[model samples]
Target: MSVTRITDVSEPLVAAFANLVPQLSSSATPPTRDEIADFLAQDGVYLFTYSNDDGAILGMLTLATFVIPTGKRAWIEDVVVDEAARGHGAGAALVEAACEYAHEIGAKTIDLTSRPSREAANRLYRRCGFVARETNVYRYGG
Candidate 1:
């Protein structure tokens, strides 16, 4: 599979997001196809899709960019692979593409979060050369 940023039409990503939304959290709101398409067109967000030679999407990774006094950074968001495509390295490939994009854009670091329940995802992150870092992340939803 090959990974490329989403642009033009992104129906595949919308479908993938639909599959992932329910798994994220019970309260999480699912986005419509238009929302996914719009987000893909936004600045500083890298939405990469993994597709087979036949041009069928198997997985996707969304990297949100941040600019702070510390430096430029990338936060990986909503990485998901179709249930049937998990073991073929699609997830890793998507991450590799994101990292490469980060480096290309002069980002100093990249970060991602996984719950303790997601053991396989944590393993994949470690295998992708991501080290555990101590930091506090707080979220407030209105």
Candidate 2:
């Protein structure tokens, strides 16, 4: 598998994203083409896809890096691997690529959150060198 940054919002990309969002969350809606384009145009956001040799997308993740008062922070979000492609290392490849890219861009730290019910995903994150944080994660909106 190879991890590639998505620089454009094409039909295939949008379709794949639509298919993956429901897998990531039951209530979350897939982003529209304009939304994807807007996100791609953002200053410090990157969308990446993990694909097989045949050029089929197997997994995807987004990395958002920004400079806050403290320093630069990188956050990985919306990670999802196609259920059919789960055992072939697509998830790992995506995470590795995101982490490498974040580090290359001078991020002070990388952060991500996984639901406890996703046992396999939690294990994958741990294997990728992420430790469980003791801090509370509060969200203000959906």
What are the lDDT scores of the predictions, listed in order? Answer: 0.84, 0.92
Model 1: per-residue Cα lDDT over 1-142, one tens digit each: 6898877656666666777666655688878877776876788987888888887777878899989999999999888887777888998999999999998998999999998788988999999999988988789997
Best by lDDT: 2
What's the lDDT for candidate 2?
Answer: 0.92
TM-scores, all candidates, are 0.87, 0.95
Put down candidate 2 lDDT per residue, 86-107, tens digits, no spaces.
Answer: 9778888999999999999999
Q: Candidate 2 clashing pairs?
A: none
Task: Tell me how candidate 1 scores on lDDT.
Answer: 0.84
Question: What is the RMSD of candidate 1?
Answer: 1.9
Cα error, residue 21 of model 1, in Å, equals 3.9
